[model samples]
Target: MLEQYVRKILTARVYDVAEETPLQSAYQLSQRLGNSILLKREDLQPVFSFKIRGAYNKIAQLSEAEKARGVVTASAGNHAQGVALAAKHLGIKATIVMPKTTPEIKVKAVRARGARVVLHGDAFPESLAHSLRLVEEKGFVYIHPYDDPDVIAGQGTVAMEILRQHQGALHAVFVPCGGGGLIAGVAAYIKYVRPEIKVIGVEPEDSNCLQAAMAAGERVSLPQVGLFADGVAVSQIGEHTFAVCRDYVDEVITVSSDEICAAMKDIYDDTRSITEPSGALAVAGIKKYVARSAIKDQNLVAIDSGANVNFDRLRHVAERAELGEQREAIIAVTIPENPGSFKRFCEAIGKRQITEFNYRFHSKEQAHIFVGVQTHPELDPRSELLKQLDEAGFPVIDLTENELAKLHIRHMVGGHNDAVINERLYRFEFPERPGALFNFLNKLGGHWNISMFHYRNHGAAEGRVLAALQVPDDEMHLVPEAFNSIGYPYWDETDNPAYKLFLAQ
Candidate 1:
């Protein structure tokens, strides 16, 4: 069988190539999973990925004539760097055609390794097509990212290392699946060496090409690929890689983008290394599988595949991580548009910090406001808060359950209020501890009324409170003076662009 041949090659070549990555036991994950859990640290490889092993092995196995002719490949990021560095080591010319949207860091890394870089097309498929055309035009050898046997055998080395390190004690291995190359290689080697060790492939639910292909009994193409996990956002699995996966992989599971982000954050918290969403797949998969299967006493291994993520993207990851874990909730509360009704609602939410508050008074009949609240980690407090709101006769809609809340409504809050003729907007920088906002509210005295307010507690040096205060026309200048007396820096929003933009909306 092909598994035997793959094992033989993996044992001989892959071990010789990528022998340095560690199979480190994760103390945090093992405790959480209720069994021994180990992380195969492929992210620690020189290229920050396992791609170099496959790319180098594939290039090395090519004939002397092929090496003389040079090679060309297409990748969104990591694979391009791998092939570029490998070709540079072999002293052969290499061309990498990448998507125009590829991160600047990746493009620079590929060029630094002496590969000619071409930015073509909007996505990976178009870049792959362009690379194929280049191969035809320039007569350079085409090195596929995952399809070839040499590449599969090279990736098999990861499984070889895991087996050698764990010595057959592992119950299951979680591998991230893209074009199916990584899982295919790992599954083939593990099934050959230790048939009892289950090999499972993890994929983003948005791009489960392998799962769909397995069900259809043929290679299947998704209509669209999600770019969030650009590393493994392949639309279709390769034929050879799919065959290996079908034969050896025990099961394929899918996880959400939020889950992937949370998993990536977990990995970062434990290892202090940022993992790309694709790299976090194995961790996300294990989480999903454990939750669904209710298996508490089984040893598992999750492969931490790559760490080539853009630093700026971490903001988005952190934002969604809580949502993935169900720690933070976005909700809307419909309160009576009266004077103390808002205050009563605020009082009802004792101790719970309001992450966001958006209000609009459409007419005298109704006042609708969307609120996002951050609760304690245990969601029981949220449940109690909800019950209290219900008892107070306020209609609450859990915007956390609404897609619009998650995507747009939470950010789109402030708007112009023509009725606020006597009101002024002020931006206050205050400390983020509990009761800070309430303390500021209490200090306002009976003279000023809060007509509108927006505040979200981000763990920063300080908390920003955007509030619209309605005071007597004569008392307008007292706003800043009062805040300054209390040691709070206040900025008038009359000339601020962000204030105007929010108000104009």
Candidate 2:
């Protein structure tokens, strides 16, 4: 079977549409990991993905009769673009059935390639079912995204290019696994040509079809799949692809969504190019492998599969990147509720950057503060920070790995605090510097109780803060005077409808 795949890969006709992407060296990642890291730039294909290789190969080899009958396929992402472009190049009528929920940009891209677009259900499965129906009704040849032998063979060409590009002492190659087609193809080719090199597969933890199949010793379907890395979000591995992978692939690694975000940032920092979550899987897997094995001075390769990410998703990616890299620590700390306690806590925290700060005056004895602090993976780890906080007599709860805290709790920290009375909410913009929060707290002083406070560093020139202070009715006139003395831009949000609806006491 391996030999047959090897022969097909060598003769694969993908070049008519897909270009041989470069295996570029990742300098910063190499230096950080102590390994020679290289990235297979499959994201640079004409359709901005490796799916083009397989799609073109499958369509180009069809019989004249089949071509005349036309082709149909279902995809909500890169595969849709790949099939559309390939069929257009081959002068064959291609009908692409995509989920109605798919981004308009993607639908436009397929239609731009001259494929008749059929917007079906809200998800891929529904689109796939509709496409199959079209195949039977219209006599259209259905193009399997990752299951067909021709498709797998075309994807194998990626491994062929890698071996030819860098004919050296390669240790292992990391490939992102979806329906297993890309890895199956690359694994078969590599195992046949250079059996010494390990072919490792990477998958999102929530969408690990290959790993589950390998464990079950057969194809096992997941009840549901995660859509974060939508390109590789397969519930079950393809039968043909899995057959090849079961023997050829060495190991599979699963990574969290945060790790994928971190890997995407790493790719962007090195290549100045962004990748979709799935495209960063191989890189994320390589990071975990290096950390686990502690291997050094070995050649590692990561397949960057695609670059079809939406623009709005970058905010979420950036927010989680530091945490994924173990460079940020989130903790809930208990401090004294007395005046100047915020300043004291900052002093205990030392000079390390505070990424986030949230506090609400709940009791006179103690205060709960949700804080995000920056830490280095090697020099000043999260454990050391926790130790420092403990030594300072500050009770702390590590929320670094708490998905609930990270995703929702952080934003919902201070809402409708009935204990907060006579609260005057004010929004401030302070100079974004190391001691800015401490300085602001010091100026605000022990005069009044701080009812609610929130500060998040957004890497902007100025840090945005929302704080509410408790003051007597007579001291209302002094509020503006105190803020003016602090010398920072401020706005009174006491009557802001959003505050009244969500947070007013």
Candidate 3:
């Protein structure tokens, strides 16, 4: 079976569209980590992703009749672009079913490649179901994003290039795992050719399909997947890929969304390339691995798989990168209402730069403040800083590791209304522009009184708003109307666990 796959990978005709991207050295990252770090620059491919290799290989292997009949596939974004570009090159009509929740930039990219675009459900699973129907009804050949043997074989070409480019004493290659296509293919090739070189798989903790499959000893469906790394937000690993991973892959490692953001910054510092969240997964894994293990002064390789990132999303990434790298520490502090309390807090902080500060006067007795302080990235300063604050008699709560504190509560601090009846809190995302906040309030504020509101501009294209509205249970119908009329995306936080624990009355 492995020999057959080797044949398929060797014969894959991907160069008609895909490029043999370079394996570039990340000098800055290497220096910082105290290890030689090489980045497999798959992000430089024609579609800004290695997906074109698999997509083009699958399409090229098709019979002339099959090509004429056309192909259909469901994708979140990167694979759609790949299939679209491959179809365009082959002069084959392609129908791409993509999630409605896919970024507008990615959707437009697929359409620009001259494919027939169909916006289906909100995620890959639903889009897959819709595409399968098209395959059955329209007589279109289905080019699955990652499952098929041909696609996996095509993806192996990346490992082939990696070996040829770097002939040094290679320690390990970290491949970002999604549905397991890339890692499976790379592992198969590397393990066959160079058995000593470890093939590690990296995945986002929330969407670790490959890791979960390996643990189960078979392919298993995830109940849900996080959309932060939308490119690799697969619910399950493909059967073929899972088999390959089970046999050839050494181990799988998971990293968080914040770590991925920091990896993006690291890649940018070295390669000047802004990678998508999933694209930076391997880099994040490398950082985590270095910190966890004694491996040092050794050669490490990470597959920087794609760069099809939404420009607006970078704002959020930039905001979280510092925290992920441990360069910033967030803490909740309580100070007296007296005039010299803030001065005393500043003196305690010493010379460390404050990244952010949020405070509201809740009572005459005390005031709570959300503070972000810069610190050494490699070392955690939370404990020492908290100790200092404790010794100084200032109360402190470490909000750095708190998810709810970082995402929602930091913005929603104070202004809790016990007087307002039937108050429903909502978290909303609106297109960021001049007067976006005013427009949101004006459009949604019909007779429902806005009892509480909290918003802070992170300079992203979307503005997140936490709002509490006063409306009676009998007038619940007005809530939907307000949302529909506002035309901004909103999620009810009235019963949100975080809201209940932190902000709700």
Candidate 4:
């Protein structure tokens, strides 16, 4: 079965538009990790992603009758552009169905590639359902993003290119896994040709379909996927891709969102390229793998998959990268409200640059300061600094690894305590669309009074809401039912340390 895929990959017709991207050296990262690192620059494609290779390959094999009918596919981002570009080149009409929650930048990009864009569904699964309907109704050929044999074979060309580019003894190759198309293709080819070179699949911890599939010994559908790495936010692994990975891929590494952001910064620092979160998955995996094994002095390669990032998303990446890499530490310190107390605290911090500092006069005796302190990558300097403050009888809380504090509470301080009773806080994530908030309120807020609300758009597929509600003891039991009826996943943030410190009742 694997040998058949190897032969097909060798003959995949992708060079018509997809160029063989360079496998360049990442010297800075190599030096840091004590290993020679090579980055497979798939982001350099004309379509700015590796999807073009697979999309074109699948469409190129179409019969004349199929070409006449044209092609249709559902994708929220890169795959849509790939199919559109391929369709344009072959003079075949293409229609792309995308989630309405897809960023405007991506929607515009698909249209620019000469494809008719259909905005439907709030998420990928919904868009996929709509696209499948088009296939039955209009008789259009559906170019699946990753599952098809031809698509997997086309993506396998990446491995072919990598083997040809480097003649050295390669230790391992890391590929980012979404629907598992790229890794399946790459693994099929690599395992056949260079069996010793491990092909590791990398995924976001929240969207780890490949990992789950491997563990279950079958394809498993995830209940939900993280949107931060939108490119690889797939809930289920493709059946064909999973079969290849299970037999060929060595391991699947899952990294946190912050780790991905840190990897993005690393890529930017080494090659001056800012990759999307999914694109940086392999890099993040490499760092995690090296940390796990403490492996060094070997040649490791990572596929830098795509670069189609929205301009506005960079700000969030920049803010989180330092913390992701442990180059900065966020600490909440409580010091006396006296004038000399501020000076004493600053003196203890020494010469390290303060990334952020926020404080407000809460009382006459004490004030809480949300501080960001710079630290080295090798050692956590926050520990020693924290000890000094603790010995001096200052209260401190390390907010470095706190997700809630990082996401919502950091931006929210100094607005706590109210006359309104039973202030229950819940963090809600809902599909962002017109009147989404109105719908949320109408569905879940008629019986309860909203006490506090905080929302800021990140220009992604979903919106996050942090709200305080006044729910009586009797109504507390109904809270779960109300949220269930509303159909949005939520976390009770009322007991969170940051909430307790800053805004709890």
List model 4 lDDT by residue over 7-31, tens digit each.
9898999999899999999999999
- Could you give me the TM-score of model 1 versus the true structure? 0.79
Q: How many angstroms is residue 145 displaced in model 2 relative to the true structure, after the best TM-score fit?
A: 0.8
Candidate 2 deviant stretches above 4 angstroms: 415-505
Give the candidate order by descending lDDT: 4, 2, 3, 1
lDDT of 3 by residue, 255-315 (tens): 9989999999999999888998899999999999998896889999999999988787888
| Superposition error at 324 for model 4 (Å) | 0.6
Model 1: per-residue Cα lDDT over 407-443, one tens digit each: 4445655446777767676666664445667887778
lDDT of 2 by residue, 233-350 (tens): 8999999999999998999999998999999999998999999999999999999999999999999999999998878778878999999999999888888878888888888889
Candidate 4: which stretches are off by over 4 Å? none
Say which prediction, candidate 3 or candidate 4, comes out ahead on TM-score.
Answer: 4
TM-score of 2: 0.83
Model 3 is weakest, by summed lDDT over 10 consecutive residues, at: 496-505
The most accurate candidate by TM-score is 4
Q: Which pairs clash inside model 1? A: 416-503
TM-score of each: 0.79, 0.83, 0.87, 0.97
Worst 10 residues of 1 by lDDT: 496-505
User: Candidate 4, clashing residue pairs?
Assistant: none
Count of clashes, each model: 1, 0, 0, 0
